[model samples]
Target: MQPSHNDQQVDLANTAGDLVPANPSTFSDDDTLSGLEKGPSTTVSSPKIPIPEPADVAEKEPFLYSLRTHKYFITVTILLSLFTDMVTYGIIIPIMPSILEHMGGDSTKTGVLVAVYAAGIMSSSPIFGVLSDKMSSRRKPMIIGLTGLLIATIIFMFAQVYWLLIVARFFQGVSGGAVWTLGLALMTDSFGADEMGIQMGKALIGHTMGMLGGPPIGGLLHDAFGPKAPFYFCLAFAALVIVMLSLLIEVRGDEMQEIRKYAVELRARDLANGIEVKEVVHTSLWKLVTTPRMIAAVTVTTLEAFDLSSLEPTLPYYLKDRFNLTEGQIGLVFIAFTLPTIVSPLAGWVSDRYGAKILCCCAVISAGCFMLVLSIENKPLWGIVLTLVGIGLSTSSFIAPILGEISAVVRRTGDKAAYARAFAIFNIAFSFGMLIGPIIAGYIYHGLGFKWNCITTACILFAFVPIIFFWMGDRKAKMEDVAMYEREEEERKRILAEIAIIKAEKKAAGEA
Candidate 1:
């Protein structure tokens, strides 16, 4: 008869069981067996010991394997969602001033439009994060958000007034939050811990490509067609994503259930093997928000965002005023800021091997120093471009490592629910930073001068260096402790094996 798969598994399990001592001396009631008989038993048992039947082994359909095979389809859908979301975001940048002016608004009001959109995204991020976690379903949220974004884009395309455009932008921001956060969560669920970093790095490549491609395309579309052209294109892309999602199976369905089941089974096995499994309980967002490391990471991210946003809006104007550069020249200079995108995957790989804290601290500090240098120099355009490239490189090096560090720390603390909450807090902080950046830069430049404002911003960024150093030290100490524990565990296992062998010899003597 052909053996069933379960029968094969049972045979393997029984074989493993027979190889180990059934009655070791270490687990005996008494160890006084020195004078026991040492010969094999003469009497043969009438009936053999009943091995567990293969038919009794539970049989269920495999979920994880199926999901793994379908990962590409899921990843592509997510990428498309991210691409459309970024396109919508980038399209507004070049046209913000023009859009506002067409409706009889000033540059300050246009700046408010940017702030409001950021604020909306920040506000909605945590809410969607919690919902995604609770539902454990990325598909519903993604589809709903993409649909909303499509509607918002259509509204913006035909918007004739500033208020109408602001409303559309606000909804777009809300949808944007869903697209980014859910896409990340979905990717994390799809990949294992080690692969997650690489997958996320690859995913960010798409975003970087979008950043590189979207604005230029939007600008060209705006110049050739009209301000409405970008939104129309966005609307079509959003529709394509919606249709793509409909065809793909939901990634977080039975696959996640299987993963959870496997985790439980592993936990049970560890218990059987006398290993302690740490129990992790879901905690409130407020409790997670109070963690010092989480707070520090969030704060640093926020400050970085504020510094970036402040520069983004004014950089073009600054170059125009200081260097008398045309729009195309300014665009070329902006491209330098994005040059780090190409190297970010490599930076992520290195950070995974070395550690994120060191990379983060160096990136922030070096970027600050370079910003100071850029502020002092009256160099040629290429020199300025190089300085901006340095900034981009520093920023990219910091990003993946910082994010990986935050996720690692949160997981170590056994607070899975806190992941999205922490991410939300990070976004909110980033938004606040964005708000502060443009406002501060505007005030500083107007009240004092360009050089002094740049100097102050650079100084502020440098201040994070010492704070990050201390945090890095703490993280290193924790890592050392983990390594020590693992070594001790290995030693304990060796001791247990020796004890088992001694017990088995005693049992053999007693049986003989």
Candidate 2:
């Protein structure tokens, strides 16, 4: 037990040699050393470790991936921005008349205040659209737009003069054009055509809520506190959104590289699947926009906006005159119009599953029919509400489908990069519709009556059906685009696998 020091050292060395293994080759087959070799057999217990697939990983930890994280965050951020914009704009509606009356401004001036915003949007949308596409990154334009919104909110909060208010509204319009045009472009770019309908439908909910809740919230705030209360609240809201945009939104600067990487991956996947990747031919933006298909989609959107704007301004007046209804009753009629729009996402889902052409055509025809019926003299209150609800349902189909169609067409035409401009054109068209609808409806109502105005609008809506049928083609091309996109995604995964293999080999060599 008490051996000499040299004897103890010899005994320790013998124990260490036994633990180390007599032959290094004996340890090569160990489970812990599986990846140490360039080509290790997985016939042992390695398969039991249960490695996860990419999709499973992505699903389990979406936030860990940059692409998924950015997409989800941006989608929510844009919706909130849209909601904030709408609420801010709407809140002013209930209070504007009072403020104008206090300042001794006439009804004409109030109309101008409303119309000027649309004018600003109409003028700025196209310019911003072109600029976004040309810019290195979309984030700059988005930030600039949000900054404009903040500045406009500050002006609304502090400015007492009517001219300053008008100026502030113009700024707000410019900001709106930027946000909608650039935001939509970003959405289209990020999500692609396949998912656009649902994404748009979801985003539209924010717009609807803003439109529905803005005036009431604004009125309550103004009534409870003071004129400054709504503005101050909106200013704080805008500031918060701006901070969110600055911190959270990320637009990859090297978008071309990313796209090419995706394309390469797709190519590799196609090779594995025994498919071919064909070179695609793209059309010029001008040629693309001027096409019958593009025109029809744009016209559908414009007419939809026209119908809504025309109805909104005239409804209260008509309700007041016909039913001798109080403000509360008039508000209920507006709800009837808005309630159908709640199902807009369902319309989008349907359009995505089926096609936009038939849906849009049917929507236009139905809306026109309802518009004609709504003009009936001495119509019952229930009948009027039903017609309004029908109109809302039909109109709800217009936006998501048309926007989806535009995205599809742009992708089909090979102008995959021009969605921003295309949607910008859409924004411009909508702005024009908004600007003219109320004014034209008012003029007709003054000259002829509400019935004549409805008649004219119905005619315009009816004209869209034939155009849609003739211009908007079948869904064959869209299916092809989807195939192409999926192939590319597969190629991306294949390339990633090769990269992983190479890295693994290098790591194994280093360890050896």
lDDT of each: 0.58, 0.63
Displacement of the residue 42 alpha carbon in candidate 2, Å = 42
Candidate 1 similarity to native, TM-score: 0.72
lDDT (Cα, tens digit) per residue for candidate 1, span 1-512 = 42222111000001111122221212222211111012111222222223333232234634443433365656677767777876676656555556666577543565566666676678788898788766646777888989998888888878888788789878888887788777766665554444444555666655554544465556567777776777788888889988877665553453334334344344444557664433334556675566555566665676566555555555655676779764445556667766677666775675556655666687788778877877874777778889878876766565555555555444443344455555666566666776667677766665665667668879888877776766542334334323322332232233233333433554567842
What's each prediction's clash count? 3, 6
Candidate 1: misplaced stretches above 4 Å?
A: 1-80, 104-107, 209-214, 247-251, 256-280, 320-329, 377-379, 446-449, 472-512
lDDT of 2 by residue, 394-448 (tens): 8877787777777666644433456677878888887777778867776677567
Q: What is the RMSD, in Å, between candidate 2 and the native fold over all Cα?
A: 16.2
| TM-scores for all predictions | 0.72, 0.74
In model 2, the worst 10-residue window by lDDT is 6-15
Question: Which pairs of residues clash in candidate 1, taking residues 3 or more apart in a chain or in different chains?
Answer: 25-503, 37-512, 306-433
Query: By lDDT, who's the top model here?
Result: 2
